[model samples]
Target: MVSISDYGDFYKMAKRNIMLAILGFNAQKHFCDTRERMVSNVLSSLHKLVAVDPHSPLNFREVYTTELFGLSLIQNLGEDVCSVYVEEFGREISKEEIFHVLVHEILSCVVEPDWRDYFPYLSWLPNKSFETIVSSTEFRRDAVMNALIKRQKERIARGEARISYIDFLLEAKNSTQLTDHQLMLLLAESIAAAVDTVLEWLYREIREVCGGKAVTEEDLPRLPYLDAVLHETLRLHSPVPVLPTRFVHDDTTLAGYDVPAGTQVMINVFGCHMDEEAWESPGEWSPERFLGEGFKLADRYKTLAFGAGRRTCAGSQQAVSIACVAIARFVQELQWTLREGDGDKEDTMQYTALKLHPLHVHLKPRGS
Candidate 1:
C-alpha cells in the first residue's frame, strides 16, 4: 500500500527518472503512433456520419467520448506498461467503470471524518473503519497491478521481452533494490500520473492548418492556436484541481511561513491557474494568454496543470501529443455543437474535474 510519496528522497528521485525515461519523447512517439492508429479505427466507424441525413444531429455525449478517449488512453497505457490489455469477464474494461470505482473509493477516503485532523496528540487511536475501507480499495487497485506485473514476469522468464515500463522494472528488479510491493506501488503511481477538451477555435485552426488531410503530430508545431486552446482548457479546468499531497520530511519555509516536518501540503492547481497576479482577466477563458512570446514550454513551473519541478508529470508530453492529434483529427472530420440546454451544467470535481451533467453535443460531418 506504500505509494511513491512514502519513499525516501533518493528512492523517489530514482523512481521518477525511470518513469521519465519510459514516458519520454521516444516512448511517447511510439505510444502516440499506436494511439493514432487506434483512433483512426474508431473514426472510421464514425465516418458514416457523413452520409447520415444532414438534418439529423448525431448525439455525442459523455458516454461516447468517454469510451473513445478513455479506452484509447487506458489501452495505450496498458500496452506501454505491460504489453497487456486489461479485461474482466472476458471483455475489455471501460474507463468509466474503472474510474467510477477508483474515484468513489478515493473520494470516500478524502471526505471521511478522521480524528487525526482534529487531535494530533490522539493520532495513536486506531481507526478500524477507515483502515478497512482503505484496505479494500487498495486490494482492488493492487489486483490489476499484480496481474499485469505477473504477466510481465512470465514474459521475461520466457525470454519474450519488450520495451515497456513493467519490462524495464522487471529487468532491473534486483539492481534497483525495489521489493515486489514497492515495484507494484511505483508502477501504480506511474499509471496514475499518466491519466483532456476544447473545440470551436480548434475547429477553425484545424481546417486552416490541416485542410482536407487529417491532422498528425507533425501538424502540432504549426498549430499554436490549437496548443493555446488546450492550455486554456486546462487552465480553466485542471483535471486534478488539487495535487497529490506532499509530505515534508524536514522543516522548511515557504513564501513567509514555516512548514514543520511531517506536514502534508497540497497545491491548489485551480487557484494557481486563476491567480490574478499571474494572469490578466484570470476568470475568463482566453487561450491568447498562452500564445504570448513570453510563454516557454521549457519552463515547467509556468503552469501547474502537469505539475512542476523534478516531479512534474512524466506523461505530460504523451498527454499533449495524444490530445493534440486526437482533437485535430476530430475537428478535421466532424462538426461539434454543444447540445441544447447542456451549456449551463457547472463542473464538479472528484479525483478530477468533471461535468456535473454529461456533455451532450450534436455532431455532423465536417463540410456538411
Candidate 2:
C-alpha cells in the first residue's frame, strides 16, 4: 500500500487540476457567452419551478435514478409529474443525494455517446441495444445543443446579450484538437467528482444537525459544533475511500524501502482516515476536535476526503456552495424526525468502488 503521504500528494494534484478546469469554465470570457445565457435561463427556470411548487413531488433521487435507469420521464414529464415521482418515493434529501443527481444529469448531457461505446455493459443493463442507446442519447444531446445554438443565433440577431458553456466549448472546438471522447471524458470526470464529494460532505453535516430545531443562516456562523461533526464524519467515513491507482514511472525509495519502477500504487484513504496515529478516538464522532484551537486537526491532510496534492477536487467551491444552499434550505424549510421506535439505530452506510452513501433513514417532516 502507498503511504499516507503519497496519497496526500496525489489528492492535492487531482484537486488542483479539477479546480483549474472549474476556473476555466467560470472565466467571464467563457461562461458569459450567448450559448451559456440560454442554458442558464432554462436551468434557472427549472430551479424556480422546483422552489415554488411545494406540492411538486420531485427531489434529487428521482432525477438521478431516472437518468441512471435511462427512463423517458425526464424527457417527457413536466415539473409537476417530476415532483410527484420524488414525493412518492419519500427519499432522504441530502447534499450527497443531490450530487448523484447532478452526476446523472451531467453524464446524460455530456458523456452519453462515448460512455455507451466505452462501456457497452451500460446498455445491456438498461435493456437497450448499444447502438440504440448511443443513437438515442446522441440524438437527444444534439437536439438540445442545436436548440441552444439556435437560441443564441436569434439573440445575436435581435442584439440581445447572452452567455453559456456551449458557446465556450464551441469556440474552444475551433481552437483546440480535443476529440469528442476526450471532451466527454473531461466533462464526466468533472460532474462526477463535483457531485459526489459535495453531497458526501453535505449529508454528514446535516446528520449532525438533526437533533437541532432547524438549521438557519443565522446558525451558519455559529456552526462550529456542526462543522466538527462534519469533520469527524469525513474522517470516519470518506466518500471516496480508495485513491485512484498510480503507476510509478521510475524506480523510487520510500521510508527506506526500495520499489521497482512501473509498479501500481494504491492508497487506502479509508485506512488513513481511521489511522490511530493521525486521530484521537478515530472511530468516534467528535466534532469538537475540529473547531477553534483544534482546527489543526485537519492541517495534515491526514483526512484524505478531498484527496491531496495536485489532483485535489477542482469543484470544491461550487460543491461546497451547493451543499450549503441545499442544507440551509432543508434546515430552514423542513422539520424532521427519525422513524418511530428506530431513532437509536445507527446510519447504515454502504460503499462501492467509487463512492459511499447512506443506505436509508426514515425521516418525516417536522411540522407536517
Q: In model 1, which residue pairs have backbone atoms overlapping below 3 Å?
A: none
Task: Please give, for residues 59-153, the per-residue lDDT of candidate 2 as tens digits.
Answer: 43333333322211111110111221123234433333333343444444432334444565674555355457656655533333233244444
Candidate 2 wrong stretches, greater than 4 Å = 1-166, 194-222, 297-300, 340-368
Angstrom error of the Cα, residue 122, model 1: value is 3.6
The digit string of per-residue lDDT tens for model 1 on 79-172 reads 4331333543344444554554444465555556677767888899998987887788787666665666666677678887666667666667
Worst 10 residues of 2 by lDDT: 71-80
Kindly give the stretch of ten consecutive residues in candidate 1 with the minimal lDDT sum. 75-84
* Local distance difference test, each candidate: 0.65, 0.44
